[model samples]
Target: MRSVIDIVDLSTEELDDLIKVARDIIANPDKYAHVCDRKKLATLFFEPSTRTRLSFEAAMYELGGHVISVPDAGSSSASKGESVSDTARVVSCYADIIAMRHPKEGAAFVAASKATVPVINAGDGGHCHPTQTLADLLTIELEKNRLGNLTVGFCGDLKFGRTVHSLINALSRYEGNKFVLISPEELKLPSYVKKDAIKSKGIPYEQTTNLEEAMPKLDILYMTRVQRERFFNEEDYLRLKDSYILTPEKLRKAKPDLAILHPLPRVNEISVAVDDDPRACYFKQVENGKYMRMALILKLLKEAGTL
Candidate 1:
């Protein structure tokens, strides 16, 4: 079986296939329902989450499968100092597949190395969130009708936005796509990500501090909260917390068809007023997340001979 530990682990063709499956499911839900009948999905979340965790659980339910969850590390064997690998090995005995979220970087990778069944990385610290990228791709495809030849702007906490990192890696493989990285200097996209996902790919990209300047040219405007959880210094987080807020007045300069996305739990970075705007696709992004996850679970289980 295969494990989805990073976006880079999936090729563009594979992503396209998943998106196609998600689209088909969206089009005819009844036909696709019960594809994973009688299967069990184990959600091993070592950290607290809402959207990602719930989306995975909802996806399994829609497929007529059962969910077995370790909602938090405090309630799991990990509280007794059980290792991730051991937990993965043990859980594989009870479930057909595993979707995991952890606060430590590479924790999913460690689990995937030991798990007998497919291990899907729900999220892993500031490192990566591959499944979120799947949702993002499906959203973009549904909205824009294509993945390539668009300018996308990423604003706010690029330094530790694992969703931003994963999405950029996935999109860079497509043709004619450019990136505008917008954030305060302290929260700029990490240098390693720039080197590996952007520069090494020879994809054109610009770095800027002005969100307004970038908005007018973007087909997609991706906003992220300056994650307080990733910062060691509370003072630093407070200082940069409100660097970029998307107000309606600010969005007036944006393209009428701009797709606004946020991997959310927005803490004042995006005004609630912006939700009424047709351009706001974050909520739509949430629904797409469930369908994409359903697509992933179906693929993994079928490959594992469990479906």
Candidate 2:
């Protein structure tokens, strides 16, 4: 009945509750093993993904739920011209919940409008990715001990980074959160996101091209790759891809406890040498993603009275 199309769809209180559930799941995995004993999760990914797709599947399996998936658009009826709404209607009969990703923005919205089951937007084009924001929130909370009263620096492809956009929207709701937007002028945070999510809420933010200048003040440093898929021209992708590579040298100016996060399948924006740093929490972000997703699944299923 209720579908999560954007990060703002869930209130701050709901976000906190989800984070609490995720932490409990982390502490006691066995307690939730059979929560979805006979439930089915349908993963309908029209776009290519590694982390989001596998994380959703892993979350379902860990909850004792079965998975029915369409791993790619080529193998799905969408390739044969079936609309996303029709696909959702069909999949609704087969699964208790749906996790969908599509290259087209608002594809999940279309699916949610038709599906009888609750729909979770896994990722939709360069638009919203609320689940990734959930993972990011859990990561920040665990690392920083609090989400508010901290400076969060978002680096790399901000314009096309759905994760970045979603996190800004979520964090702006919390008190005393300042945003440091670091990206090339061409890839700066969209004006609409700036106006609607940040400015309208009277949240303070700074725009910069220098990552090093923004480093020292940050409590959380989120790195995002310049997506090749989002770029229409290959030359633009190649030119901007290597813009901000986070190396040990870059972290020299950063805080000792700065939580480094990436909604990854990282394309070398982060140097491998930095992986051993105590501050590096991107892999932790990946693990947290599964837990947050598990929590979300439980909540949505319970809301739909499917659990």
Best prediction by TM-score: 1
Q: Model 2, range 122-218, lDDT digits (tens) per residue?
A: 9888788999999999999999888899999999989978888889989998899999999977789999999999999998999998898999999
Estimate the overall C-alpha local distance difference test score of candidate 2. 0.92
* Per-residue lDDT of candidate 1, residues 134-168 (tens digit): 98898899999999999999999899788999899
Alpha-carbon error at 125 in model 1, in Å? 1.7
C-alpha RMSD values across all candidates: 1.9, 2.2
C-alpha lDDT values of all predictions: 0.90, 0.92
TM-score each candidate. Answer: 0.95, 0.94
Off by over 4 Å in 1: 227-243
How many residue pairs in model 2 have overlapping backbones? Answer: 0
Top lDDT prediction, candidate number = 2
Q: List the residue pairs that clash in candidate 1.
A: none
